[model samples]
Structure formats: structure tokens, C-alpha cells
Target chain A: MRSSLILCTATRFLLPIILMFSFFILLRGHNEPGGGFIGGLVAASAFALYAISHGVTYAQQLLKVNPINLIASGLIIALSSGLFAVFNGSNFMQGYWSEFKFPVIGKIGTPLIFDIGVYFLVLGIALLIIFSLAEEEEEIQ
Target chain B: MNLIVLPVILPLLFAVIMLFAWKYISLQRILNLVGSLILLIVSVLLFTTVLSDGVQSLHLGNWKAPFGIVFAADILSSVMVLISSIIAFTTALYSFSTIDNERESFGYYPLLNTLIMGINGAFLTGDVFNLYVWFEVMLISSFVLLVLGGTRNQLEGGIKYFTLNLISSAFFLAAVGLLYGLTGTLNMADLSEKIKLAGDNGLITVISIFFLISFGIKSAVFPLYFWLPSSYHTPPSPVSAIFAGLLTKVGVYSLIRMFTLVFTVNSEFLTNIILIVAVFTMVTGVFGAASQNEIRKILSFHIISQIGYMIMGLGLYSVLGIAGAVFYLIHHIIVKTNLFFIGGLIQKLQGTYELKKLGGLYKVYPIIGLLFLIPALSLAGIPPLSGFWAKFLIVKAGLELQEILVVVISLFVSLLTLFSMTKIWNEVFWKPAPKDNPEISFKHFTLSKKIMIFSPIVFLAILTVIIGFSVEEVFQIANQSANELLNPINYINKVLGRF
Candidate 1:
């Protein structure tokens, strides 16, 4: 898109902050209103902003693993989290809680892990689509 | 974990595994075969368990029924899953020989496994919203499979297939929303009980129509079937065969499930509408097949015609009728998939699907011709074959109901179906090969490739014959499945944990 210098610099500055906010949203999802889906969208938009200002290749470099790999790993993590219940003698996707709490994170649970998996999945899929579209546009140019 | 959820989970797990093994095509094939074999074993085990234990229902996350996602497998769901696994196993085997490396490299195996997972999930889900989610999963994977090659024909077909399906999904979602608004439940069993209490409201009838339109498009019944013929023949043979075999049947299964389990059948108006739709669907589908020259297209239109027979069983809404529909569904999946596989072999040999350009198969490859005949005759309702039994039950049900006009139309449709089969037999097999046609010698194909192609066809054809000869056993299962449908008490009690 070749935006103006101010917009490009602004995007570069805001990207990390946006990604951190997305992680915050994901972490609060299990008990609060924000969840993995919305969190992932926020993160994807940050990267999308970077791709637009800098170029897709730079965005690709930042994403060391392919989006497909991210998607697969995310799904595996999510599915295995569900299987934790089976090993614990509960039904599939049954949530198990541990007493340990880390800093401000409260109780650790399988559902939270599931939510994190969803976060990565949604982020990867969104970037995959956006980046492909951006690259195709670049090729046309 | 309970075995009830294995059919859905195993395929999903394999799909993810295949994604990681994407760079290794041979390894992916090995994984696909092993996964499919394991799925078949799981499905058969589940079916046996259902047979012995009655319906099995599991609540995900240990949440109680009507609140949590429930996976319930009754005789009907178990049998459907078993047949689906069988077809998937065969399709996996056939794809080894038929699907090109380009498509394989593009994640075909993963998508296929994901599609199986979707089908299993759809078959077993007890919640309406969960069914919608599974449909989306199935549809997305199917959309990818349809256009994997990126050929012009494939993309064109993909557009029509996906767009219409998306519309159907929207209709399905809207109907789910309205039903929830009225009854305050999305669970099938709970909805069944509540809808009964709600009585024969005109709004309920409208809701039924919404469901009818939505599922009708999916099953390609009657006037809403334009997208099927245009799209089904575009994919690679194995992809098309699996689509031909499983996809529409899922729609029909949903129709049977919703109408039989959820909706009250007190309205004669609804039954009459379905009856009319069934007759017209049969007539139109067979007529469409008669006009087609391409092998897969002919088989594609025949799929629509065969669907009418299944819907007729539902329209009858009798014990025998539903049983007949169930039997027809099982028979059609095996026969239709085998026919498509044979068509693929024909295409491979002759390098064309057009009837005018294909010939001399009977002389050159008698075994292939015989393979073709089994499904062809069975599809035409010849005696001692699966199709004949399927038709007999439906026709007998019609006669018992004294639906003379529909019986006549059904009989005439069978005759017409036979006519089209003969057309294929004559043009593709009986006629002499045209001069200048390159003879496709069997010498060109490696023995393993030949085995890969032939084994699935032989296995499915043998299944059709076994089902035909052992009609009593198959019919008994269908009858029991039908009885379960006719009475949903067990299904409801199990899912709701009322027992």
C-alpha cells in the first residue's frame, strides 16, 4: 500500500503494543468478556498493519513458522487439552483445575489452555489469509 | 474417553498429524491408510457396542445434557458411521493410485481426514447448533477438496457448490435460531419433547418448511438440485466418489433425523408436500441422467434420482417406509461410490468420460465390465442385488399405503434408470473402439497401482452383493433402526440421561 512515512512509522511503533493487548485479552478470556477469537483478531490486525506499512516479506520473517504449522499446532494443543479430561476419568473436553496460581493468573485450568490454542489458531488463520491476499496483490503490481 | 466420540476424534487427530507430515507424501499415504483402517475398526466396534448396549450418549466437559454438547450414537448413527468409514477407507486406498501429486502436496489427505471428522461429528451430534458447526467443518473441507487442483472446471464447480451450500447453511442457522426462540432449546431430544408440548402451531409448520428447504438443497431434492450436477463431476475421481457417496446422504440422514426425531408428523400437509417432492425429484433426476453423455455426470444425476427413493421412504413415514429408506441409504452409498470409482477407472483407461469417445471395455477388460455391471444392475433395481431390495421395500410400502400414483412413478423411474445404465453399457463397453483411439493397455499400470484401483471397487461390489444375498440380516438391522426412529424414547432418555 506504500502509506506515508508518518503512518508507516506509527504502525511500526504500535504493532508490539497491539500484540501485547491481544495477549492480555486472551488471558482474561476464560473469566471475562474477551476471548481467544476476539483476541486473535486484534493480534492479526496488528501484524496486518505491519504487512501493509512494511511489506508482507517483513511480516513473513516475523512469522518464522508457516501459518499452516501454527494452525496445526494450535489444533493439536486444543484437542490434547480436551483429552486431559479423559486421562483424568472425565468426559472429553472436561476441564480440570489445579490449585497453583501464578502471579495474577488465578487458577490454572484446561479451558484456559484451550482458549490459548484458539487464540493461536484464529491468529494464524487470519494472518494466513491476509498475507496471501497481500502477496497476490503485490504480484499483480 | 467414551467410544461414542472416537469416530469424530480419531479422524481429527489424524488430520492434524497429516498436516505435520505434509512434506512426506509417502508417509502421508501410509498415515492415511493406517488412520482410515483404525477408523473402520473404531466404527465397527462402536456399531457392535450400540447393538449390545442400546444408545450411547456422552456429555462433553461433563456438563449435563441439554446444556452441554452431547454426542449420542444410536443404531442409526452407528450404522451411518460404519458405512462412512468403509467408504473413507476405500477412498483412501483409491486416492493412492488416482489423485495427482499436486493435490496431495496441497494438503488433500489432511482435508480428507478433516472431512471424515466432520461427517462423523454430524452423524453423532445431539445438538442442533453443533450439527451446524459440523456442517461448516464438512463444507469448508469439501470446498477445499473441490477446488484443490485449481483447474478452471474445478473452480467453477466449487463456486456453485459452496455458494448454494452457504445459502443452505444460512437457512439452517436461521431455522435453528427461530426454533430456539420458540422452544428455548437446541438439544434434539429436548426439542422433541418441547415441540410436542408446543402442539401443532402454524409457526412450527413454518419452521419445518424452513428446515425442509435447507436440507432439501443439501440433499439436492427436486427443483433445488441444479448445483449438484454442475459441481459433483468437477473434482478428482476419489474426491467426487466420496462426495457422491457420503455428502448428500448426510443431508438425507439429517432430514430423516429431524423429521423423525424432532418434528411431529401430525400434519398431512407436510407429508403430502414431501411426497410430491420425492416423486418429482425421482422423475427429474432420472430424466437428467438420460440426457447426459459423460459417465460421471450420468452417475451424478442418478445420485439425485436415488435420493428420491430415500426421501420417498421418509415421506411415507411408516415403519416399513423408514426402514426402506435406511436400507436404500446404505445400499446407495456402496453402489454409487463403486460406480464413480468404476467411472474413474474408465476415465483412466480411455482418457475420456464422454460415452461417444469410450468403447471396447467388455472385450478388452471383461473384469472391469463385470465390475461396472454389478453396481449398474444394482442401481437399476435388478433382483438379488442391493438396489432391488431397497426399491422393493419402498414400493411395497407405497402399495401398502395405497399410494398408486407414486408407485407407478417409482416403477417407471426404475425402468428409466435401467435405460440409462444400458446406454452406458452400450456406448462405453459394447461398441467397438474407434480407430486412432490409443489403446490403454494394462501393461502401462504397475501392479500395485492396479491393485490400489481395483481392490476398493471389488470390496464395495462384494459388499453390495453380500447385502443383496443376505437381505434378511441387513433388513433386520434396518428394521431395528427404523423402530428406533419410529420411537425416539430411548434416544431421548439416553441423551437427556432421564434413565
Candidate 2:
């Protein structure tokens, strides 16, 4: 499959915006319908789009790390977020909100950390699938 | 710090650590070994705590029961977790020698821990949806494990296993959705109470059948068991051993839990159906085993047959019967896994799994033959072995219930199991090697590899012998679990904190 110059130029412009929007969705997920899963998907689509416009190798170079490691780190982060409650003398995954509030993100808490973990994990998984399939297609061609 | 969560969390933790340490094979191996040992220790602690404390529960996010997800462990859950950890540990040891570097580097250790996490989560979760999630975790990891080597046979078998299990999961999800719609709760204890109040026995019965089909496919009962023989023998031996030991048993575990806890209202009819399924599963499984020419295939079929006895116990529906089922479950896991381990060892030594191509194992290695005899005899329900006690309990419970037909069928199946075992022994051990069979020896393995493989088989064989010799103590544990199962009121109270 040959990449179009127009498509490549559009991806170059749209990638950062899509990634930023995914983070927005992830942050808003605490109160709204969106969460780590959707946000991660959005972020993954950004990279996926870049892979489609450019190439698998270019996308991998851009990502700079293996997606599997991303998944592993995401899992650790998510689990540690849950562990915060255990450290606080409560059951696993108990939510404990702090009194301080941030300007843009509002309240920074374990739930946000959990969502970040999910975001990384979802992004990793989606990218892994996309990259593998794309590379396989490249091979077949 | 909640003890209940450790069984699930520790595996996830170890899996992650191993994932990051993937490039270093030695590090992964050490991590896998240490993780299994740690899981074993934690499960033992969880088991002891549950035994002494009656019932332990942890409500996630501090969400009280009937609302938030809860992880609960009574005697049954704790015992299953403990036994599963033992298998995980031994399978880890077995894998050290048996699994090749290709598979190990292909994320085998992480996947194994992930599978254990899923199994433990299924055993411990108090919420139905949570159980479904755990099942998915198990299935995903198993799917990868099944096809990790990417051999043609592995891929073929993996597809069958994957498709069937996916359908089963769909059914389970449908049942969960329907139940939640009908009763507005997913917690097992809450569902029990709400199911009693809902008074919609007809729909509930329909949901129960959906569950029966779902879990039935999983446990390999009767018509649904075709997947077991086709795919189980295709994976590597350690993989097969773990799968044989734990996967179907998780289904059986879910069956016992759901039927006892939430679906008890319509059990009279359901149990009658279970009894018929159990008998057919036994006869067909043994017959399948007898017809098989290979080692793992025979053992695979026998897994189905042995699952029959556990279902039979549930069908009996008394404290003694359920206890019998529990004992059979524990006994079957140890014996079946050991048999598969021995099968692997046989392949290692003789370079063939085909009984027709193999022979003279007994003459060459008497100790290996003795090791094989212990599990083989126990599996055949010979006296002074664990399987005998397990069978005795189920048969005794059936007699008390006057279910003479199942009892007779069970005994006949036992004879057939013996026949299958002896067929293996005669071909693989007793008879001389056929002409043109390549000569092979156990010394082909390095010393540490030999110890790695043999120690786990020996450990499990010893466990079988211990359970056999100390039937009273094991039975006492099973009986206690049975009583708790029979009386879910205590469980309900403990989880909901009504007391």
C-alpha cells in the first residue's frame, strides 16, 4: 500500500492534536463517560494513523520504546495506585481523596494515577496490535 | 495489606516484573521460580487464615458488599487457591527442564503468572462479573500459551480451544447480564438473597441452564468435552500439565460455587441433569482414553472422565457428596498433573509419545516406573492412594442417597480407567522397544535439568501418597468446606457484614 503525500501531510498536522485530545478525554474521564480505555484508544489511533501515513518502522522510531514494556509499566502503575489504599490501612483499591486541588486537572488522586496506567496500557496494547499487523502486511507485500 | 487480594495481586506483580525482565532468560527463570514460591507461601497463609477465621472478605474501593466488588474466601476458595498454587509451583519447576528457550523468551513466564492470577481471581471473587473478568484473563493468557510455539498442530488446536472458550465466555456474560437485569446485583451472596426474593424461578432456571452450558464446556463434560482431547495434547507438556490440572477445574469450581450459592432454588432438576451428564462423561472419557494410542491424549480424555466424579459429587448434593467432590477435585489435580509430567519425562527419555513406538521404561528405570505406578494406581482408584479415598467418598455419598446407578457406573468407569493406565504401562513401560525405534536415554538431559523435571513429579507423587495415607485430615478439610457450602447463610452474613 503506497502512502499518499496528502495523507502524510495531514497525519503530521493531526497527530499531536489527537494525542492531546486523548489526554483531555482521559483527564475528564474521572467525572464523565470517558476513562483510560477510551483515552488510550484515541492515543493509539494517533500513532496508528502515523503508521498508516508513514511506515511501521518510522512509527516504531517515533514511539522510541517497545509497547510491551509500556503495558508492563502501565500495569505496575495501576496496581500501585490501588496499593495506595493498602498503605493507608484500608482494603485494596479503596479511594482516598486529598484536600488539595489542582488548577487544570482539579483534584490529583489515585484514581487519576490509575487512569494514567490504563491509558499507557491501552495505548501499548493497541499500538502493538497495529504495528504487528502493519508489519505483517508489509512483509506479505 | 488485605490477605485476600494477595493471591490475585502477587501474580500480576510477578507477571509485570517478568515482562520487564524478559530479555534476560536467567532472570526470568529465577523470577518465575521465586514468584511461584511466594505465591505458594501466600496461599498457605490465606488457607490457614480462612480455616481459622471462618470467612474472609475484602471489598474493593471500600465499597460495601451488595454494591461494590468483593473478594471472599471461605474454606472452598482458600483450599482451591492453595492447591492451584501448588500446581503453579510444580509446573514452574517442571517447565525449567521441559520448556525450550524459544517458548521462554516468547513471554512464557509472564503468561503463566497471568494465568495463575486469573485462576486465583476466579476462585476468590465474590462478585459474578468479577468472576467473568477473571475467566477472560485466564482465557487470554491461555490462548497465547496454547499457540506460543506457533506449530501447525498448536495453531489448529489453539483455534478450537479459543473458539469454544470464547463462546463459553459469551454465554457466561449473557447469563451475568440477564441475572443482573433480573435481580439488580452481581455479588454472589447478594444474588442469592435477591434471587430468593425475585421469585422468578422460570427465568432464573433459564439463566442457570446458560451457566450450566457455559461452565460445562469449560469443565469438559459429555457433549461439550470434544475440545479437551483435540487441543490439550498439542501444547508443551508443562503447559498441558498446568492446563490439565487447573483450567477445567476452574470451570468445575465455578459450577460448584454458582450451583451451591446462587442457583440453588432450581437445583433439584438441574442436579438430575448433572448426574446424567456425569455418568456419560465418565463412560465416554474412559472409552476415549482406551482408544487413544498416545500418552497425553489418553490422559486428556481421562481428565474428562475424572471431571465426571466431581460433577457426580455435586449431583449427590449432600455435605458428604460435595465434600467427596471437593476431595476428588484435589486428588485429580495432583494425580493428573503428575501423569502428564511423567508423560513428558517419558518423551524425554524415549523420544516418543506414541505407545506403539515406546517400551522398556520399567526395565531401564525402575524408580521412574515406581513414580509412575503411584499416580497411575491412585488415578485408577486403588486403595491406600488419594484417588481411592476420593472415589470412596463420592460412592459412599451416592449410596447414602440411594443413587445406585451412578455408583455402579462410577465403579465400572474406575475399572476402565485402570484398563487405560495398564495399557500405557504395558506399552510404555513393560514391553520391549519395537524394531526401528531410535534408542534414547534419560542421561541425555543435564543433571540440573533432570533434577528440575523429576523433583516436581516426585513432589506431586509424594503429595498424592500423603493425601492417601492421611485421608481423615484431608476429609475433615473437605467436610468443613462442604458444610460452609451447604450453609451459605454464614457466607452471606460475613460478606454483607450483617453480623
Candidate 3:
């Protein structure tokens, strides 16, 4: 195996940049292109890179909670954002837009928030499917 | 703004909350049981509202149709929602007695809740693509539950199940793609109007056949049925019970909805094909049922046969035919699930769902044997029970249509159904128990398990009796749903804003 120095250096140097770009992709999703699903996939890719260099055991140890819980949480958030319309006396999954302007952030709506939830859900489910399957592959090792 | 969205929302929220409390058995159990009870109330509220007001809709985020999402509830949908959740509620109760502690710890409640979410979402969705997503969600969750044990039997069965389903999904996706290209819209109501305007054509038939192949695999109709008996038998009791109870019925429900709404214009071609499929499906399925030695496996084969009766109603494509199908669906869903649960009870009491290994249950638990007998003969379509009425409507529809061959096949199938039920009685309850076998004792059951398992079966079995006695009211409800399905302008206007 390669030395731990190479792996640690890669994760430390690359993770923040990857996360920043993921948010960039998510924020621009409504008009220009990149959306929650793609952003989530990108963020998950960063984690995959980390898990690879650091070893899955280290990644599991570093994770505060299980990936499956993240998936459930994401589903709740995504579903709730849609249902909020119902509670608000609007129709289900009817996009609720709110106008906002910020110094750093450009604009946001319930769509963006919903997108964030979808992002997290996709990321979590992807990781869960990948890592578990990987672990199973390793168990057979 | 429609009221259709709440039923989907509340359970999805519960599914998430239930996940957090999965470590605490008591908390998860409370949440799931309470969650399903909440669903039942929500469904009832929806049904009563829709019954009065007709179909209601909520456009997501106040977005207008053809632009943003729409969630809808109609009289037909709301009633089905009620039936589905009530079944889920009862099954959750059944799970308490059947699932081991390890299953509880493995996020069972959360997954089950989510599975219901997927099921409800599929039922309630107004859009076709959204239906596909929800179908995948339910199927994936179900696949996990099927393979939860990872035992040799489960793995073997899981592989078969997954392969069959993966092929189905590929076809489903292709059909969706083709339909999108043809219609340029994924909304079901919108597609209906457009399709009617365009009129029935060869391309539409191609798309419809694609869907039939996809759903037929799921429904396990005729030749697509082998995967079901082998695979459904491998899951644990709760899985088997719920799978037996609700999932395949979802396939049948969608098939009924789609054909009536989108594909029935070519009545001679499509309807005649469905009739033949129904006939073949019934004969083959009953033959399979007659041949089986295992309990749930036999019941599994019978699900295919019963789907034939439902198809008969649909294939006839009349008010009487569809109403009969709807009534039969409601009857079959409850009775079949009850029989499966009785199979579970048989397993609990006798330690097997095998006919060869079980006998003389009438001596020890005569009440259970009685409870069991009502559903068994009812399933066999004997008179004065709910099953007879369901079949009566379909057979009457056939006679009205003068489809003598189809009607004759339906009769032969019912006779075979009776033959198989008698086979079960002779093997399981009438004969003496084996001398060497140990009997299940009271010590084996906990109080919660008893309430959870027995109550729902008893309640549903009673409802079956009530439906039989109250055939007029049941027929009215079915007739109303069928009228709405046939004259979909009501559903169409409600969803697409009177265009």
C-alpha cells in the first residue's frame, strides 16, 4: 500500500475545495444547470476519495452517525419541504418561491431548500449502497 | 389547492422519526403502530371529504398544472388509500408477534413505514414518471426486507426476485421513455385527454403492451407467475403476510386504472387479450395451487388465479365489469391477506406452513379453525360470503357481455379454488396431528403479539362478512368508483382544471 502521508495529504488538501464546489453546483442549479442530485453525487465522490485513502474502518470511525440515518433524515427534509405547502394551505409539491437577496448568497426559495434535502438524500443513499456493498466485498476477503 | 397531499406527508414524516428511535424497541413500535393508526384516520378523513366534494388536488408550491407538480385525491384513490393503510396498520400489529428482537433493532419499523410511504405515494401520485419513482422506492425497500435475513433460502429467493424485477424495471423505463416521446407529457390526466384526442393508434398499443409486460411480471400473471410462488414463500411471516396481502395488488390496481383510463379504446384487441390472459391465468394459477404441498406457496399461486377474476372484470370493460373488478379487488385483498395470516398462525401453532407436516387444528383451536374456515371457503368463492359477491359481479358481467368461454373458465377456476381449499382443510385441520410433533403452547405468545396479530385478522374477516351482508352499499361504492374511472372527465377536469 501507498504511505499514509500521501492519503492524509490528499484528503486534507482536497476536501474543503470539493465541498465548496458542491455548494456552488447546488446554488446554481435552478437557472444555469447543476442541481441537488449532481451536487450530492459530487460531495459523495469526495467522501469516496477519503474512504479510499483513509481505509473504510477509519472513515466509519470518523463518521459521527451512520450513512443510512443520513438517508432517512434527507428523505424527511425533502418530503417535509414539499408537505410544507400542504400545511401552508397550498397544494402538495407545489413549488413555494420566496425572494431573497444576500451579500454572498444570490437568491433562495423553498426549491433551493428542497434541493438541499435531495442532495443530502442522494449522497447518503449512494454512500450507503456503495460502502455496504464494498464492506460485503471485503467480508468475503 | 387540493387536500390530497396530507396522506402522503404524515407517514413519510413518521418513517423518518421512526428511524431515529429504532434503537428503542418500545419507541419504534409505538411510532409505527401509532403512525399507521394516524394513517387510517387520515385516509378516512380523505375518503369522507372526497365522497362529498369529489376529487381534490394540491399543486406543489402553488405551481399551476403542466408546469409544477400536482398531488391529487379522488373518491377512488381515497378509498384505496384507506384500504391500503388499514392493511398496513394491521400488518404492523401482526409484525409485533412475528418479528424477533433482532429485526426490531435492524430498523424494521422505519423501513416498514417508508415502504408504506412508497405504496401510498404510488397510489396517490398524479404523474406517470412520479409513479415509476415511487414504484422503485417500494420495490427497493421490499427487496431489502426480503433479503434481511441473508439466510440461504432468503438469498436464493432474493436473487430470483431481484432478477425478475430488474427485467421488469428495464421494460418499465423503456415504456415510460416511449410514452414521454409520444405524448410529450408525463401527467396521467393530461396524457388521458391528449391520448383521447389523438385517438387510439398502433404506437399507443405498443406503449400499452410495454406497460402490460412490466406490470404483468409484477402481478405474476400466467407465465410470469413462477417467480412469485418460490420467492414469496421464502420471506418471514410478516413479510410473507404483507407481500401476500398488498404488494401484488398494487400491480393489479395500476393495471385496472391504466387500462380503463388510457388503453380500453381498442376494446376488441386489448380487452379480448386481457380476457384470454385472465382465462389462462386462472386455469394455470389454480392448477399450480392444486399441486402445491406448502401452505404460503399454495396461497401465493392462488393470488395469480384471483388476479384473473379481477382481470375478467376489467377485460369486460363495462360499468358492471369494472365495478365488479373493484368490488372483487376490495374483497380479495382482505380475504387473501387473512388467509396468509392464518397460514402464519398455523406456522406458529404447528411449526410449519407445510400441508404434509400439519393436521387436526380443529380439535385444539376450534375458534381459529372457524375463523380460518370462513376465509378459506370465501376464497373458494362459496355463497353468502364476500368472495361470492366479488365473483358474482364478474361472472354476471361476463354473462351480460355474452363472453361464455370466459365465464365458463371463471367457474372452472372457482371450482378448482374450492378443491384446493378442501385440500388445505384435509391436510392441515381435519386429520390428526403427528404423534411425535410438539404443540405450540401459551408460553410461546406474548400479550402484544396476540393483540397485534389476531386483532387485525379478526377485524378484516369481520369486514369481509359485513361486505357480504352489505353488498348493496359495497356495490354502490364500487359503482361510483367505476363510473368515475369510466367517465374520467370528472377526474380529468379535477386534475387539469376543466380544460
Q: Top lDDT: which candidate number?
A: 2
| Per-residue lDDT over A1-141 for candidate 2, one digit per residue giving the tens place of the 0 to 100 score | 678999999999999999999999999998988989999999999999999999999999999999989999999999999999998899899887778988987878899899999999999999989999999999999
After aligning candidate 2 to the native by TM-score, how far in Å is the CA of B181 from where it should be? 2.1
Question: Per-residue lDDT of B289-364 in model 2, one digit per residue for the tens?
Answer: 9999999999999999999999999999999999999999999999999999999999888777999999987877
Positional deviation of B141 in candidate 1, in angstroms?
1.3
Clashes of each: 0, 0, 9
True contacts kept of 1: 0.78
| B132: Cα error in model 2, Å | 1.1
Sort the candidates on lDDT, descending order.
2, 1, 3
C-alpha TM-score for every candidate: 0.97, 0.97, 0.95
Candidate 2 vs candidate 3, TM-score winner: 2
**What's the residue-level lDDT of B347 in candidate 2?**
89
Of 1 and 3, the candidate ahead on DockQ is 1
B327-446: candidate 3 lDDT, tens digit per residue: 988888889888998898888887888887898788887887888888988899888999999999999999999999899989999999999999998888888987766474546887
The superposed Cα distance between candidate 2 and the true structure at residue B198, in angstroms, equals: 2.8
Give each prediction's root-mean-square deviation over alpha carbons: 1.7, 1.5, 2.2
Worst 10-residue lDDT window for candidate 1 chain A reads A62-71
DockQ of each: 0.71, 0.76, 0.59
Candidate 1 lDDT over residue span A1-141, tens digit each: 477899789997899999999999998888888878899899999989888888999988977788887788888989989999888788999888898888887898998888888988898899999999999999998
Which residue window of length 10 is worst by lDDT in model 1 chain B? Answer: B435-444
